[model samples]
Target chain A: MSRKLLETEGPKWVAQGIITAEQQQRLTALYPEEGRVVGLLPLLGSLLVGLSALSLIAANWQGLPELVRLLLLLGSMGGAYAAGEYFLRRGANDSLGIGLVGLGLILFGAGIVLTSQMYQLIGYDVTGLLAWAAAGAALTFLYQSRFLFALTVCIGGIVQGYSTGQLSGFSYFTAALTVGGLGWYWWRRPDAVLGGVLASGILWQAGLLISFLHAKITWFFIPAMLVYAAGDWQPDRPAGRALQAPPLVAAFLFTFGLALYGETDTYAGLLRPPLLAYLSALLAVLALSAAGKRARGRLGSLTDWLLLLPGFYLPSGLALAVATLVVLYAYSGAVLWRAQQEHNPDRITLGITLFILTTMAAYFKLTWAFMDKSLFFLCGGALLLGLSWYLRRAAARALPPKSE
Target chain B: MATPLPLARRHRLVLLAVAVQALFIIGVAAAGYATTAWGRTITLRTAPVDPRDLLYGDYVRLHYTISQLPRRLWRETNREARPNEPVYVVLQPAHGAYEALGVYASKPAIEPRQAVLRGWITNSWRHGLRIRYGLERYYVPEGEGRKLEKRPVLLVKVSIAPWGQARITAVNALAK
Candidate 1:
């Protein structure tokens, strides 16, 4: 709650015999005049500096002495961290310190890349990225830096993508880190637990998806479904009240996967259609069970289940895929109606968002003549804007007046 | 994020970590320099690869003549190299490029400067022995790699030390 709200309400509560003025004063004193919200400027400044450093190293036209490049890498990476630490010792400059540390990590990875570039090393594809992620993860665990948390997740995802597969053993390392890192985050900061879980989801899914992409397209659905199911295993606390990682990641996979199938029709695969379909159906049930667990007490009622629903009717025809979206639309409309009756603003927003996404996904299945394509997209976009405005009005009307 | 460390102690640890990380970054470069400075240098003709990765940015995905070995080059009792096993390509300077005289299941020692490039077999079957040289990547300056890759014209200078430690020295665009 805002300090202004508490102060304004305190005297009223005291007058109504809710509490004494002394109690009100005590309550107001609990929260500070200005809460410690992290400032964005320092982080942005450090990011720009990091980017310039990368660009300078990458654009090595001078063919400077190899030793000089090495020194540059070491100097920047070490210097940034040292400076960040110095600044960090001052209590007020915490954000600036964080930003500098972030730059140090970036330069650290860039140093590795630049070294590889200098000597022209090979087969070190995911090795450097994985190493960078490892360092970032370690720092994140120690310092509890959110920037490092995000950086580690990104680097780890890239590492997982570049590593050929589980057989390469790098993917296994990434998976292990995800589990380890998630545990560390949960223990250190209860508030950051959801973010940790989501990062883990990225680590878990990217390797699986890429490996499947390389091996067999049909097998990709299993991991996609599996991650979706895993998304529901949120902590049994208010902290897990954020966007669950597994399901959102699964949704991303579906978006890309469906877009691929919608664009390119490929019949070639390792497993036959019947078996793949059966496997998909089995995963759908598993995911539904997990989703049910999450729905025990969660917001965005219909949103979580949308990605899971379509997997059941897999190896879908373009027509079938388009048709199934009708079911999605009807489901969302039901949630919308129920939300309106119950005055649940969150559900109403989720319903509208899901409704639009289904419509957009349904668009790819469509085929328009070359001349009419532009017109079709223009009309579709205009329709979406109109729908968004309508939903806004509906939600605004359904909400109750704010109480002081 | 446990009980906050004493400020001075935390600063010391941060300094130590920063130093360690710096050493790591520089250590890789030192290793890179060591490989090139001490290793024997060899020139090999570039072969056509997928070319997508090489044609962009500071890193070039190089495919050398030794990377694609003929079945006859596999002088093993078995027709193909074992799957996921390291295969050494015994190199002899041919008329132009270094030719792979044989692919060994294990490291085969020879006279000094006689190159024996080591690589892992992807999947070796009859009539083929597919292997990847750790020498496949050749980094260049931004936008300069594509020009070096002009077809009918790409010679790469490679330096190799013991235990298959290798580095790309130069990728010269030799005119036919």
Candidate 2:
């Protein structure tokens, strides 16, 4: 609890005979007031100074002699690293230390770019920027900082983006580094936030790779689901679920889009990959995911895979749309059913939201063309109100009575 | 999670890592100098782009005359040229600037006067292929890029290192 809460409530507890005033005084002493606001003033001041310095150097960058510019780059980079080490050794402000170190890492990248630009150098390969990502990975390992791990993931994305978009070639090595370096780190550490960040970073690279190849977009799911399967193998439940969330969201959105647009044969045709190859790859991932779920005794979550059903393979018509909607309802219903069984209030709320969304989509899709405008609104409103009431009542009955 | 390294060991590693990064940046600079000092220089012609389109920040985007070449210059006849495939272009001096003599999937032996510059095929079509040599961007001194944009045509001096690195050394307007 916060010191303010304790200060306001401690005397009342003593007055109520829950504890003596002496005990209250001791408890109050347990939570020392933080000097965070005081600490922030100097940080803000330093940030302003740093930004001013940066602007001045940037404004005069081209005017400066080459040697001076190079010296400034290296000198400032070294200074940041030294300051980071000093603060880290001091141990009073670890985040600030790590922040400075991260700054050094960023400056290293800027240095590489600036140095190349100085002599009008053009590198056909990614070697220069790859070093930046490698350094980031190394720092993350050395410091064991989530901040650095996330930073490395971002660096990997930026490098891959440049390699593909500008250089016109996919840097498979950079992709491998992110998956092998940062992925291994996340696998060992299993942080929920980092897991989410890592998964999204990997997905971003995978998306770029797919675009670079000009492959059918459906091929994207292969790498995306590979990420989801990796999450299944993670021993930490919360972190694993966090990692799985992005791929699941992507699949859900794709399936929802299919429901809305599957009536167009052209759209459905674009989604079809070479059937045998795609199915085999997807099935292999499914087997891996199933095995991991079984090992972790989380087989109930297998319902999440329902969204991956290849409804687009069906001939594009009302049939495909209806099939997709059925899958959505089944998946959301499974979520609700499982949430209620586990008495997880958060999951119940999510399930309710998904169910309502699916209902709205289904109602709009089936009725919008034929129904009168006023009647359509009237019916949608009434249906939503009735469905919400039923779902909330069901939720209330499933959850235990709250004591507070 | 792997246990964090001991503080002293971590410090040493950080020092090593930072030093390596610094050295890498220096190496890039050194390569920039090396390419110009110990490399063959060739002049290529650029069709002037719109002045507004030319100056982007401190760099001017150059469209070299060799940027697009007839597909017949593609030496590999067995397979279709793929986008983003790295190809070697042999250049021979014609008039004041080098013109593409041939495009090969692999580096081809060139006569003493001919130079091989590496580029990637950005797009390939029935009759022609568009290539990017990575020398398309010329970083200019502050406010200098705008002055080059107005020229109808310009000659860019590029140095191609023997080790397959290439860079733009200078750009000048074609003498009327």
Alpha carbon lDDT at A209, candidate 1 = 51
lDDT of 2 by residue, A1-404 (tens): 88898899998999999999999888889999899899889989999998999999998898898999999999999999999999999998898899999999999999999999888887788999999999999999999999999899999999999999877789999999999999998999899999899999999999999998989888899899999999999999999999999999899889989888887888866799888998999999999999999999899999999999988788999888888999999999999999999999999999999899889889988999999999999999999999999999999999999988
What DockQ would candidate 2 receive versus the native complex?
Answer: 0.67
- Decoy 2 TM-score against native: 0.93
RMSD per candidate (Å) reads 8.0, 2.4
Query: CAPRI band of model 2?
Result: medium
* Weakest ten-residue segment in model 1 chain B by summed lDDT: B49-58
Clashes of each: 0, 0
Lowest lDDT 10-residue stretch of candidate 1 chain A: A263-272
Which runs in model 1 stand beyond 4 Å of their true positions? A1-64, A164-170, A182-209, A212-231, A236-246, A252-303, A310-319, A330-343, A356-398, B1-6, B33-90, B101-157, B169-176
Q: What is the lDDT of candidate 1?
A: 0.66
Superposed by TM-score, candidate 1 places the C-alpha of residue B18 at a distance from the truth, in angstroms, of 1.8
Alpha-carbon shift of residue A12 in model 1 (angstroms): 23
